[model samples]
Each structure stands twice: as structure tokens, then as C-alpha cells.
Target: MNEFQPITVSRRSSREEREIALMQIYRQVLERVPYSYERKAMAKAERDFLSDKIGVRRFLKELGHSRVYLDSFYYSSANLKFLELCFKHFMGRAPLNRDEIRDYCDILMKQGVHHVITAILDSEEYRKVFGCFTVPYARQTKYYESPKAYLESDILNHEHVAQRGRAVPTLYWHQLGLNCEGGVCITIEGENPALQNYHPEMKEAEAPQGTRIQQELLELLHGLDAVEAQRLVASLHRKQDRA
Candidate 1:
């Protein structure tokens, strides 16, 4: 009787390796890049490019040309803001100081946005720390001790904050029947006659529609258990009957 031996193979074909590399690049670009809009379209485009075997530098350049990038970062934002975006998207770090900002801004002004992006990706610093396979992460420095502090700093000014605030289309404040500032003045004129009485502590005109007793009962029963709620209701009913 011959003994059966198990064989183990640990190797991937060139095509398989290339596919894996492309998928990795896609993930890194998608995850690291900060596109404000058209995320789904951008992801699809990256996948398509991977299928076509487009190199990383070209992939990054293509991402930079995206509508979201063009509208938000490239065309709209200032040179300094663009440099900051490049740092966040490529190196996963905030610019340490004014000099660093100036140096990048100089590059952007001289070579252009695409060249600046390519330079960052091809930098010896980036290559040494995060190779092609590894995803770049934020390199924490002493300038901003923590993420909270970093966000609070002048680096993230109100202009940047306001730029990110997109107007929600489906959110109709007018449909809520609110005034211009989302406030409504309650008046007794069109309200139910039974609800005209004001709370004792409140100003007569500013009082709620419902009586104090009804308000108290509602507050009491708001989060009660079944037994407790029933008991409270029965007690209130008894008190009403006695009155």
C-alpha cells in the first residue's frame, strides 16, 4: 500500500498578479481620494480604468480631472486649498507649516495641478513610507496634537467649511408650514376654543394650546411601561371623577 502525499502550491500567474495590483490601486485611490460628489461614477470609472490596465499615475491624474475634483478642489479652491487637498488625498497628512504650503503652492503654480499630484505620488518620502501595495495614512505631527484639535485649527477655516455644505434638494422647509426662519407664532384666533387657556407660569399670549393638566398627563405617560401607564390613567380618571 502506497502512502498518499498532499501537495501545496503558492504562486499566482502574471495576469492574476496584475489584476490584484490593479484592484489594490483602485481601492487606495477610491478610499484615499476626497471627492465631494459623484462618488459612484468615480468608483465605476476607476474600475473601468483598472480593467483597461491604466497605470497608477494615469489613474490619479484621471481622478484629478473628475467633475467633483474640478468643481470643488481644482477650479473653485485657491492654490493653498488645492495643495492641502493633494496632501490629504495622496499623503494622508495635513501641511505642517506655512513653508510647506508655499512649496506645494509654488509647484502647483509652476508645473500645474496634474504635475503636483504626480510629484506627490512619485515622491521618495511617499514611496519609502507607503509602497505601491500599502495605503497611505495620516502622519500625525506635533503641530496639531489630535484630530479634534486639527479640525478646530485655523487650517480648517470657515470658507472650507462653508464650501462643503451642499444644499439638500429634497429637504423642503416650506412644506413644513414654518415661517422663513422655521418658527411659527401660535394664535388663539384659528385654534380650537378648548385650547385657549394658558399655563399659569407662562405669559398669557405665549401659553401652549393644551391645559396644564393635559400637558402634565402627556409628560407623565410619555415613556411609561404598560402597567405603570394603565395605573396612572386609572388614578387620573379617579381624581377627575372626585373633582
Candidate 2:
């Protein structure tokens, strides 16, 4: 196995960007750890078996036996901001791997949890810049699958509308933009507005529910001690905000 490498980030990036990279790195380390899939599956099956063998009320009580499994899957989450920042510094991007992408499904099987990853990777916010890499859904859309689908009318014009409504907020990726001693600069352009608008409707028609969950998630990131909250907020897309 390849030994882990250290990354030297540019001094010019903003404090926020640095923080995000750090948080993402923390997430990357967590991703490398192993979880017990067989144990969880066996336990779940046992619960069901017991439920079938016993009465409903008895099974209900037994179900509480797996509270740890439920908590880790449904409630527990690792902080990825440090991991994101580390990737930004070393590779200048986020790591896109099967283990990284599919771990959530391994941990949990709920519909809502599945949608969170889909929205971030599939949304225009991601597609606009890095372009789409994987389509997790059965019904893939053209915009997500093809960058050419983004017409001038869709993003530019819609940006005007979003700006008018104060709905779409601009994000600066400059290394030193938000929190830095000064001197470094880098900017990233994201998905156009028109296509971005369609993202929410196509996925859920409500908003990015993942972000709301993230607000609580931020509180749970315990291991990383040196990072700040603003940095993670910057990396996150404002899915819940109204347009």
C-alpha cells in the first residue's frame, strides 16, 4: 500500500478555503477506515427473525437492542471538511472513488440519506465546474450527463433572476478571499443559473434537504479540533434557501 502523503497548500488561499480543505482531509481519513458490514447485516436479520418468532410488542422491545446500529447509520456522520481541504491543497480537487461515494449506502439504506450524496454530486453546483462524473439514479438527466446542455439562456439569465430575487448567492474560490493574511487569489465558476434552478426540481422539487441535516452534522464533527465553521459552510451548497 502507498504511504499517505502530506500536502502543502498555497499560502494565498482564504482562511475559509484552507479550513474546508482541512475538514475534507479529516473525512478522507475516516473513509479509509473499515466498518463491520457482516455484523450489521446479521444483527438486522436476527432482529427480524426474533420479531417473526415473538409477538409484535416483544419485537418492538427487541428492536431497541440495535440502537447503536441505528444511531451510526441514521444519526452519526463524519466531518469531511478537512478531507475536502486536504484534497484541494494536494490534488486541487475532491476525491471521487467508489468507496467514498458508496459508503453511505453501506452504512444506511434510507431513501433520504441516499438522496443527499446524489444532490451534491448530481446538482448543477457540482456539474457546472468539474462536470458530472457518475450518475447514481436510474433516471439520469441530460444536463448532469452533458456539460454542453448548459445554454447561455439557462445559467446567465437565471443568474440575473436569482440575483434579482437575492436567491442565488455567489461563491468565491479564491485561496485568500475570505480569511487570509493576503496576496493569494483563485476563483472558481460554478453551474449556470437556469440549469442550477432545474436541479432542485428534478431531484426533489423542494430543496436540498441534506444541508438541513448538515447543520446538525456540523455539531457532531468531533475529532477535528483546528478548523472553523465558516469554512465548511462555504463548501456547502445552499440547498434549503428559497429562490
Candidate 3:
């Protein structure tokens, strides 16, 4: 008679494996550890079966339900800003145009923030591009460049720079012969009459129309030789007069 042998195969339950996967995805997508608010929200979501069978939509909805998300993003000052953040965080790109921003803003206002988030997460575009398990990443190629390039490029903007608690000092503007006050830039002294007028304290005489044109020409053709630039300016003046 042969002795019966018992086979032992080790395997995690599907539900347990799913929970582990969900936790990992949450860490990736959220880009941070679970704070107290997030922990509480996640617990509630788990109880509600949202985190159990996690899809992008359910995951984002759970995040949106958190106090941190509501306080940080939903209550941001501007709807456009909030929409922009949603694109950056969820779709990993900037909004394509004003129409897209407006449409999403309308969704946010009408459907609430969580619905706005879910709509984005469940969108055909998101599903086609990112799928269920893939983590979202910045789609703008420029973002991969140096931090200075990212900050100065149109992708981040002044509002985003300020929101990140990093100071993009006005020294850059000063170096470029500009003076910034209250976020408005004015040309430094002797730059241009139009820009000079912007500085009320300068007390400089208003330049003649031709002088202003010449100043603009000088600025535009700064890289050219002075004689060539002057000739070009004179040619432009002649053409303007003929017109």
C-alpha cells in the first residue's frame, strides 16, 4: 500500500491580492502616503466596496471623498485653476483649450467635485490612454526638462508656481530690464515710451510716436548691427507713411 501524500500550494486569496494592488495603486496615484483624512476616507471606501473592486473611477472617487482633496483642490479659488489641476493630476496634461476648461468647470459646478473627478477618470479618453492599472504621468514633454524650464514654460504658470510654495523671484524680470509690481511688468527706464508710462513714479516725458516706433524696432532687432537695425527702422517708417 502506498502512503497518501498531501500537496501544499501557497496562494493569497483574490480579494487580499486585490486589496494589496489597490493600496499600491493608491500610493502611486495619490503621490503621497495616506494621511489621517485619507486613511479614514479609505476605510469608509473599503467598507463600501469601492476600494475592493478598484477601477480608476472608483479610486479617484475615493480620493475626491477625502477631506484633504476636498479642501486642497475642490475649494481652490478659481474654477479654471481647479480644472487645470485636475488635468495635471489625473490626465497628466494641461487643459487643451478654454473650451475644455469651461466644459469641465461646468461639470464641477453642476455635478460636484467627485462627479467631475469620476467623469474624467471614466472618460473614454482616459480609459483608452491609461487603462485600469496604469499610473497617470505628465503628458507634456516640456515637463521632463529642467525645473527652471518647467517653471518658466507656459505649462506651470504663475498661479501654479505660487501654489507650490516656491518663489519665482522677480529677479529674472529685473535681469531682463523689466520691473514687476503686483504681478504686472513694466519696462525699466529708457526701454520704451509705452512701457515707461506704466511706471507712474518715473516722471519721464511721453516719447513721440516715431521715437516709440524706433524704440520698439531697436528692441525687436536687438541682435542685428545698429546700422542695419536703423536702416530697417527707416524702411519700416517709409512703408508706414506710404500706407
Candidate 4:
């Protein structure tokens, strides 16, 4: 909303801290806001939040139901665009793909707006990521269990919405060899984003926990010379002996 201020929030934050956090939530959820207080619904939601009547999740629920949200994101925008916007606002990433977009559209068409909100807010993913007190933020791929989550998150989080100023699904053009980051995106050899933190793949099986542990250990020992590795091993042995 205003640059990117760091919001160090927790369940135990003071009222003033929570108020500041609410500002961020408003900016994120109501991307097309007039003034928060100027809107009767927004004002009431804020009051309920500040007075301890609702948590950040519920505040988001109310905001999603606001006329501003319905008018701008749901009514005016295409369902595909609306789906991506909901992911961004509520779940903090793009829909995994066209299949997800269709599923959400079906929900909206059959169930209604309240169900749309309930589905996301009540989802296990939502609870695990944002919980009750936390405000949803642009989540990283690792935060999700879906193998496709990072692929979509990496591809979309860096891009602006309706970048063409046309409301459409984020993947409306993905089939046209949009490629991906790291190995997925076919770019000039050095031009693709770093493989360490940002990468893309439609989906992948997670390595087993034991394999992950081994990989972590390998990472720790990667650059160590023989003597250093010996010393580290010896140190660990000593610690075990003490235990």
C-alpha cells in the first residue's frame, strides 16, 4: 500500500501494533479502496477488529464481503481474474492453474460469495499459513504442500495483475511457451531467476524427510576440506559422548 513496511506481528502484539497491521491488511485486500473510514462497512469492520471482537482473518472475511471488493473484483472482473485476485488477497498467491480457476468459478456460481469466502478462509492451507490472528501475505512456494504451488507463485508473485490492463486469468497466456524460472523458464542462459530461492515447475514430488536430511548434511559439508570434515565429525562425536 505505502512502500513495503515490515510488519512484525504476532498474537501478543499491542493494540497500536495491531492497528498498523490492519492498515496493511486493508491495503492488501481492498486494492481499490477509496478511504477506509469513508466506507461504512470498512469502518465498522475496523472497529470490531480494534475492539477485540474479531481477528485479522475475520476482518479479511468482512472486507471480502464489502461492496468495494464485490464490485471491483467479483462483479466487474472476469471470474478467472477474480479467482487470482482472491488467491492474492486471501491466500497470497496465484491460483495453481486453469483447473483451480474453473473450480473456484464453479464454487462461486453454485454456492455464492459467502461460500467463496468460507472455502478459502476455512481451508487447511489458510489455517496453516495465516491462522486466525495473522494477516495473509504473499506466501512463498515452500509454504504450500501442493507441488504446483511454487510454480504458480514464482511465476505470478513477481508480475503485476492484469499487467495488460485487461482482467483475465493469470495463465491466460501460459500455454504459449511462457516457460518458467530456473529450468522451467527457457531464457538466455544467465537471465533466468536464481535457482536457489525462486524457480518454477508445474509439479514435483517432495524428497523424503530422510533424503532431505541427507541433503542438508551434504550442504553443510559441501565446501569443507578433509581435515575440516574430520574435525566436524569429531566435534559431533564429542557432543554425543557428552549426551
Candidate 5:
């Protein structure tokens, strides 16, 4: 991936340039896996991105849910291990702390894997790092809090199944100094800003009326089909006149 270099696509970019962007985009998302020719699952997504009908973010969502990714990473790996891989591929890091892992694990258990994939791609951190049109790459420059993020990246971004198995997080081992030959390991922690407080399911009873409405709205729009989503959004506009 050339130090996870960025080959961004713009509306003004030439066809050949966008094509190159497509190649690198796949490399960045799928890692060292085969992202061309054999990937019939991603054919429509490929066409949309090439024609500028979809941005890199949307393309990434497709790639994240593709059967290749599910077979290679999701279904094969446990929830924690899968979360670590998603962080490396989409967000360019590992679990910052136990809470971060727990939060995603919560979402994974409650909402299913596809939502977890979309949550990472839809994060504010993701928007800040790669935005809509730019490709996501495992680059350290985007992460400055700790240099170990790169090390964690290396651990989580592998094509081989994580040696830690599906249940344990890579960060836990890194904390215990199992990932390296070190005397001690300090904590590497960050908040759960990515998933918009996806932890602790704030369903009907738990959340107050206003928060409950927001939660319900979010749920409604999340995984809906196109026509249904459009209709619901229109109804929301007609109904929710608040800021």
C-alpha cells in the first residue's frame, strides 16, 4: 500500500486517475487480499465508484460488508477480534481501551455486524481522517496520541487470523506486553467517540423521551432500503421541525 499512501479521487480527476484510485482504494480496504476480477460481490460498487455515483465512504461500506470481508474477517473472527480488524482497516488503529472494545462489542451483540462496519465508516474520526471522497489507509500520521498505534495496526491488519483467537482483543495482549519484548506496558486509552454512544442500548425505557425519539429515528434510518429510507426521511422532515 506504499506506506498506506493516499490516492484521492476528485470530480475533476481523469478516468485513468480514478482507475488508479480504485486500485489503491481496494488495497487500502482489503489489505493484501485479491480485490480485483474475482470479486463479483463488489462489481456494482466498483461501477458506482468509477462513475462517481458513490464516494469512497460509501464504497468502503460496500467493501466492508462484502462476502470476501465477512468470510475472511467477520464470520471467521469473534466480535472483539473483528472490531480490532475494523479499526485497523476503517479507522487506522486498535481498541484504545477496554471500554472502547466493550462499547463496540455491545453494538455487535445488539445490532449485528453490518451496523458495526457502518458505524466505523460513519464515525467522526473517519470523516476527519478520510472524509467522503478519500480512501482509508493504515497511516500513523493520522494518529498522533501514541506511536504504538502503528504497532497495533501491524498486529490487527494482518490477513492471517489473529493468534489471540476471537474472544481476546489485541490491545489486551499489547497491554500485558505479550505483543512485544518489554518489561511493562502503559495504558493506551481513548473514548468511545466513534460510535455516537452506541454503548448501553438506550432503547425505549432507558432513554428519556427526547433521547428515545432520537434513538428511534436513528434506528429507523440506519439499515432501511432506499425507497423506505427516502419515505421515512420525508416524513421526518414533515414532522420533526425542531433544530
Candidate 6:
């Protein structure tokens, strides 16, 4: 891609506006990019593009935050379009089809949700409520097979869904729900001794240590640019080899 290839994206409209856009893209990417080959190649490409467009420090920072509240931003249509444009700029050609690009962008919005949620789960804040069960797989893969299974046939493609049930499940009693800026607040902190006592053992295990969604996204910018960077490095090595 030309270094100076001029591309246009919608200017920053608002915080919510941008977040909404991110969500939309995330959803699109999830649908389009499935299976091992596409997943690996796309992840590599995304990582490369992100590093090149955004510096590593900034990218990691974004990922760190994404570990927790990824859904807050993903699942929005507007953000997905912006992300697609970003991907286009990163790769010279349109590497992702329109739908594929859209879906991946949505997935990228969740860069660091795992880390943040893990931290919160460990915190004293919700120890009582979260003491039972384990956070379910945030991302899960399921295989499909037919009755006519040939030994040589590669198992058909798989399906994936964001795991809704956390490792622990919470039971809520019907008390007056509090209406706050945050969603439903059903607990009175420190007052619920019975609830705390009833809770089960809280596990402190960690999720995979890596980029949360946003961080992955930020890294993706750099990764995209790095493709050219590596090419430059390789070309330099080639010249040195010739010399």
C-alpha cells in the first residue's frame, strides 16, 4: 500500500458514537472469520496491521481496558464501519471481504475484557456475589459432524458464541431494584451477610494472558504497518546479502 494513500473516516463524533461503532465491527468479524486457517491468518494480519498503525504502547493500553467491558463498545453498527476503513488503510488491498472486515472489527473491540473482569472477580467488591462457579469460556468453539462420517473427512466447520454464564452464577432475590447510571443494582454492599455466607468458594484462576479486545485492536494497527516494516527489514537483509 502507498504510504500516503489518503483515506477518509468519519471524524470523532462522540464517545458513545465511537463505542457503538466498535461494537458493530466486532460482531461482523466474529461471523466472517471462523475456522483455524482463516482465524490464524486474520489474527496475524490484524496484529501486524495494528502495530504499524498504532504504537505498541497505545495499543496495549487499549487492550488492557478492553479486558473488562468489551461489550460496552462492541455490537454497534457505526463503529464497525469506521474499523473497516481502518483495516482498508492498513492493508493495501481489500484483504477482508466487506462482511468479514465488519465482523473482525467487532471482535477487536473486546481486546482486554478478560483481564479486567478477572481483576474485578478477584476484588473484595463482589467476592460474595461471585464466589460460586467459574467464568464460562468467553469464546467457545463447537464442532459439527454428520451421520456419514468418513475417517479422512476433516470435521466440518465449528460454531462459536460468547459465553454468557460466568464461571460462577449468581442468584438474585426480588428486592426493589435500584435505578442508577449503572445497570440493575440488586445488592446493598456490606449489608448482605447472609448472601455472603451462602456463597460458594471463589476461584482465583486467571484467563489467558494476552491482548483484551481493544488492545488487540490497537496492536492490530501497528501489526498492519509492521507488514511493511518487516518487508523493509527483509529487503535490507537482501541488499546486505547481495553486498
Regions of candidate 5 where Cα sits further than 4 Å from its true position: 1-5, 33-38, 146-151, 154-167, 177-243
Scored by lDDT, the top model is: 5
TM-score versus the correct structure, for each prediction: 0.42, 0.19, 0.49, 0.63, 0.64, 0.16
For candidate 3, write residues 81-196 as lDDT tens digits.
45666666677665654446557756776777777788888889888767765556554443334554453334333333223321112213323344444434444554534423
Please say which candidate is ahead in TM-score: 4 or 5: 5
Q: Rate the local accuracy (lDDT) of all candidates.
A: 0.45, 0.30, 0.49, 0.59, 0.61, 0.28
Model 4 misplacement above 4 A: 1-11, 32-38, 143-151, 177-243
Reference-based lDDT, residue 42, model 4 = 77
Tens-place lDDT per residue, model 1, 1-243, is: 435221111222244554554444434444334443555657766565445545445555666656655565566443444566567656666555444655665676667777787788788977776654344444444566555446423332222322322110001111111111212112223433323332436643564434433334333333423454344333322121110
Candidates in descending TM-score order: 5, 4, 3, 1, 2, 6
Cα lDDT tens digits, model 2, 108-183, are: 3344433443444344644553342111111123343234223211322223111212211121111112211122
Put the candidates in lDDT order, highest first.
Answer: 5, 4, 3, 1, 2, 6
TM-score, candidate number 3: 0.49
| Model 5: per-residue Cα lDDT over 1-243, one tens digit each | 545457688888777877787777666666654645546777888889888898888888888887877877787654555787788778866766556766776788689889999888888888898899887775655545566656666666553444444433456444432321222222234221211233226557765443443343344334434454334333322121111
Of 3 and 6, which scores higher on TM-score? 3
Q: How does residue 151 of candidate 3 score in lDDT?
A: 39
Lowest lDDT 10-residue stretch of candidate 5: 234-243
The most accurate candidate by TM-score is 5
Error of model 3, residue 6, in angstroms: 40
Poorest stretch of ten by lDDT in candidate 1: 167-176
- Using TM-score as the yardstick, the better of models 1 and 4 is 4
